[model samples]
Each structure stands twice: as C-alpha cells, then as structure tokens.
Target chain A: ADAAAGRAKAVQCQACHGLDGISKLPDAPNLAGQNEDYLVKALHDFKTGERKNELMSTVVKPLSDADIANLAAFYHSLKP
Target chain B: ADAAAGRAKAVQCQACHGLDGISKLPDAPNLAGQNEDYLVKALHDFKTGERKNELMSTVVKPLSDADIANLAAFYHSLKP
Candidate 1:
C-alpha cells in the first residue's frame, strides 16, 4: 500500500482521528501504530455490521476495499 | 481524582496501553486526551458486559469505581 496515497485519503478521518492518526474525539480510537491487519479487519467489520459502532459504520460505508487497505497502511505508518 | 495516584495504578494497563496512555496493541485504543466521561462510561460498560470485549472485560472486572475514575483522569491529562 502506498502510505502517501493513504495519507491523502485520510483527510476525512482527521475530524475524529487526527492527521497523525491519534484520536481527537473520545468516542473514537487512535489508529496510529496499530497493526495493519487489525485496522483493515476492523473497518471491514464496521462496514459489514460485525462490529457495532454507528459512527464507524456510517463512515466506512463509502469505502472500497482498496480504500480500507490504504487507510490501514496510512494510519499504521504513524507513531502510536 | 488524584491523577498522580491514578498514574501509579495504571501500571497494569501498560502492556497494551503505553505508560503515556497511547496504545501499543492494535485492539486497544489510545486513552490520552479522551473525554473523562466517555472513558469512564466505556470502562463501566466493559465491567458490566454492556460493551462486549473479552480483554477489556477481564481487565476492568477488578477495577473499583474509584479506580476507573482515577485511571480516566490520569489518561485524560495527556496529549492525544
């Protein structure tokens, strides 16, 4: 995954997740330095209703598989 | 809430959560700069099984309300 491209796609996430991949909102979780596989799976779960977070579900609804991968890569590249 | 005391009690959380309140594990969420109320409620939910995370439930089972409050206070004091 191209982390630079992922970073560009991560703009929308900055409201709750900081540009640095740390969370700005209490309800959100920080993504920086998290495992790439975990992040991808979590996003997939949110999109599929396997994980039950309304906000996360809503946010992930529009993402494609590539988008999820890129996002995971981008966030994982950051410091925890 | 004695944040200093809370910091001392947070030793157990450092395995998955860094001493700085950032998460070292993928499944764990960063607690720094999170809202106190949200953190407290999340912990309460974990303890009560309202939130269904096995690891969190196990960790929170032994926490007293005071412990939860103190931990929340300590983590909330850090940068996000």
Candidate 2:
C-alpha cells in the first residue's frame, strides 16, 4: 500500500499516541514530525533482532517495504 | 507485502533507537517488547493528527496497514 494509504490505515494507534500522533501516555513517545529516516529505522529495529523492545519488535518484525514507507508517510503528514 | 519484509526494511531507525529497539537517546524511545497494539498506536499517532510529535508525525503520516502491521510485528518480536 502507498504511504498515504498506510496513513489512512493507522487508526488503531490512536489510544496512546492520540489521533494527532502525539503521545498522551508517558510510556509512549511523541512520533509526530519525527525524521522519516529515523522513523523507518525505528520501525525496522523493532522488527529485527537488533532492537530489543519486545512489543515493538514483534509489532514491526512483520512489516514490508510498502508498510514501512506508508508508516513514514503517515507520520510525515501529521502537524506534530 | 508481509510485515516480515517491512521489518527487513526498517534498518535506518537504528541510530537513536539502537539495534535492540531500546532508545539510548533521551529524545528517542525503547520500542523493544512494547505492546503490539500500543506500538501500532504510537506509529499511527505520529502519522495522524490526533497525536502531536513533530518528527514522528511527519515520519509516520505516510504509512499503510501493511506498514503498521510490519512495524507492529517487529516491535512485538522484541524482548523489551
């Protein structure tokens, strides 16, 4: 899917991060307006063994290139 | 594409997040072993307008469902 499409698909994450992409939960971090390069990498790190976060790793480990791009797009589009 | 593929694609995030999904940088976070639902939410939060992180929102605003899933998969795989 296109990143725009991915952005549209990312509705489930609203609880902690908020509808606007900010972290309402202290456990969560602000993702809005972060670097696309870093975002992509972070998502990837979670998937790969290189990163150690269990929840994030499992969540991201299954992502594809299209998925990564779309995620990057969705975050990039937000106002922060 | 599969989230596994997406997981493969997210290598760049290693800088701040570290290869282990743990955030060595104060500005960054520890994605490792985070909740899959929550991880997905954080990424989406960045992309959408509900959450408000400048860098993250811009980075994720483009993600697709595949992207979100892939990211979630990767994060979930981690040990935290």
Candidate 3:
C-alpha cells in the first residue's frame, strides 16, 4: 500500500512497463494512472492463469499478494 | 465526452468488455474506472497500429475521435 515501497518493488517491471509506467513495449499496456483495483485484479488474474500471456504469466508467478498490491499502487500513482 | 452518448456507442464493446466495462472475455482488460486519457490513447494506438492486436485494431479502426472520447468517459465513470 505504501507508494515508496511500491517504487522499490517496481524495478522488475521497468523493462516493459517503464519506471514512470508508460510502457516501453508496444505490447505492454501503459500502467500509469490505471485504477489500482483493476491493476491488482489483472495481476492476480495473470498469476492465477485466468488471464494468460506468456510473459505476464512468467513475470507474475514470483509475486506475492503484497508485492502485487505495491506494484499496483506504484503504477496507479503516476500521471498518464 | 458525453457519458450518455458513450453508453449508447458502447453496444459494440459489450461483447468483450461488458456493458459495465468489466471484461467478459479473459483476454480483454477491464475498462471500468480506467484513466480516461489512457483509454483514449489506447484506442488511438489500436487504430494507428502502434499497438497490434488483430481484434482491437479492427474494432477501433472505424471509431472517430469523439467516439473514442465518449467511450473513455463512459467507461471511466464506472465503478471498478
């Protein structure tokens, strides 16, 4: 829930989704200013195999609930 | 940016993204409560082929700027 903590956890996500959440890859949706709840749900879906993207599935597999929440918070705090 | 007009225009979107913006299909991201600017940008990206997804590209090809804005407003107005 802490934005600062989320920032720290966001390093892993910076390659595809930029540090500012503006998506470096065209295939990756920009995360900046996205709804926190939606981001959390999306991450959970990716982790659970409900939403299947090869890269997302692999990336989210190691994330815990707290990590997912932090990542969502970090992304949602940005300006689009 | 009329949410009412957007609601009417959303009939086309209802199949994959539900009438309320929750996704009916697993591959579709939920649009409810998403940032309006982000949604507009996403639609443009799909239209321009900057982002490539067969279905999205086809869906957005016929949408005008006003239609995109209205759709964004309507979806952003929803609860996540």
Query: Cα deviation of B55 in candidate 1 (Å)?
Result: 1.5
After superposition, candidate 1 runs with Cα above 4 Å error: A20-26, A29-38, B22-38, B78-80
Against the native complex, each candidate's DockQ, computed on alpha carbons, is 0.25, 0.04, 0.10
Ranked candidates (DockQ, high to low): 1, 3, 2
DockQ, candidate 1, vs. native dimer: 0.25
Better of 2 and 3 by DockQ: 3
lDDT (Cα, tens digit) per residue for candidate 2, span B8-66: 74675667676567676655756665556677776765666545556767667677878
Residue-level lDDT of model 2, residues A11-63, one tens digit each, is: 65567666566777756655665556667766776666544556666666667
Best by lDDT: 3
Q: What is the C-alpha RMSD of each candidate to the true structure, in Å?
A: 3.2, 16.0, 7.6
Which digits, one per residue and each the tens of the lDDT, describe model 3 over residues B1-80? 99999999999999988998877865576777667776888788788876566788898988999999999899989876
Where does model 2 sit among the CAPRI classes? incorrect
Selected candidate, larger DockQ, 1 vs 3: 1
Models sorted by TM-score, best on top: 1, 3, 2
Error of 2 at B60 (Å): 27
User: lDDT of each model, Cα atoms only?
Assistant: 0.82, 0.65, 0.83
